[model samples]
Target: MIVETPQLILRPVGTNDVSALVELDSDPAVMRYVSGGAPTPRAVIEDWVVPRAVAELSSRRGGGMWVALDRSNGAFVGWFSLRAPRHGTQPELELTYRLRRAAWGRGLATEGSQTLMRVAFDAPDTGRVFASTMAVNSASRRVMEKSGMRLTALHLGDNAETDGYERGEVEYELRRSDWESARFVWAVRGSTSELTA
Candidate 1:
């Protein structure tokens, strides 16, 4: 259990996860917003997705995609992550999350995202963690906002060329300084005591 949220677990997605991944990734509703129309094929899951995810876990950097599981029944809810792109030219981390449609509206996404930021800032040396989404992905944007990340920029996605990127994409970022401030704010709220004097 790398990260334990109120209703989810962020852990390594290992070989044992193949079945669950297959089932979750096959769900039409779950992949709707992602692929825009199609389910993730098993071939993609077997030969690419899972293997690539595991490879990320092997990196020296703490950033990598993680499996998110339901705390109640231990079922696979989906996945969330803050990963540095493979190109390595940019140091920026990409924040991401995807959960089963049934898991929507439960606040699990926000809880899991906040935990990722905590882990990132807690690391020995930290930079920034940002997540981007289709401007239309209000749900994801809400999670990013709730995690204390703010909208930093808007751009036409490279691949948005196909996914209607021409419309635009939004990036939300949380810097170490900002996270530190939020921590202080939370600490203050948690510490404030009612005055009786």
Candidate 2:
């Protein structure tokens, strides 16, 4: 599937994205929160990550990972995902993203996240959309909030070796009912503006 936003073009990840993915993950700053600044081995990305994403794309599942590109220049910015949680049931998908350090502070994460949430809520079967991040990662938490998800849970880290494990993890979620209500309000506000004009 292809999804476009004002500043990004998102497409299903493929073998061609291997190098870019590796480069993105190789940056210590980019992977700081994920792997304690360790670069993901290229073999792991090539032999596992890309193939799994390709398989998930073809699985006819409601969600999969998408590589994000800068619309004007086609630069690889990062990737975003909306997929079933490893231990969670249907109607509740997980939202997650990782952008190049260069892409930070530009609001691209929040923009892509908000768009993906809309896509999730468009499907009648999707009852909730959720995301999780290290509690100390205030930037990611802001993206979740800007995308309209509310804090729902805090999970203690299971591994002491992981960075920021002591602070734990935070999960945020947006329910279908809440999304619909927000859409209605936006529609009404737009209509009122048009009438006034």
Report lDDT per candidate.
0.75, 0.85
> Residues 28-78, candidate 1, lDDT per residue (tens digit)?
666655666467777788788778777766764567678898888988888
Clashes per model (N, Cα, C within 3 A): 1, 0
Return the clash pairs for model 1, or none.
160-165
On the 0 to 100 scale, the lDDT of residue 186 in model 1 is 71
Least lDDT summed over 10 consecutive residues: which range in candidate 2?
188-197
Off by over 4 Å in 2: 191-197
Displacement of the residue 68 alpha carbon in candidate 2, Å: 0.5
Question: Which lDDT value does model 1 have at 4?
Answer: 76
CA deviation > 4 Å runs, candidate 1: 157-166, 191-197
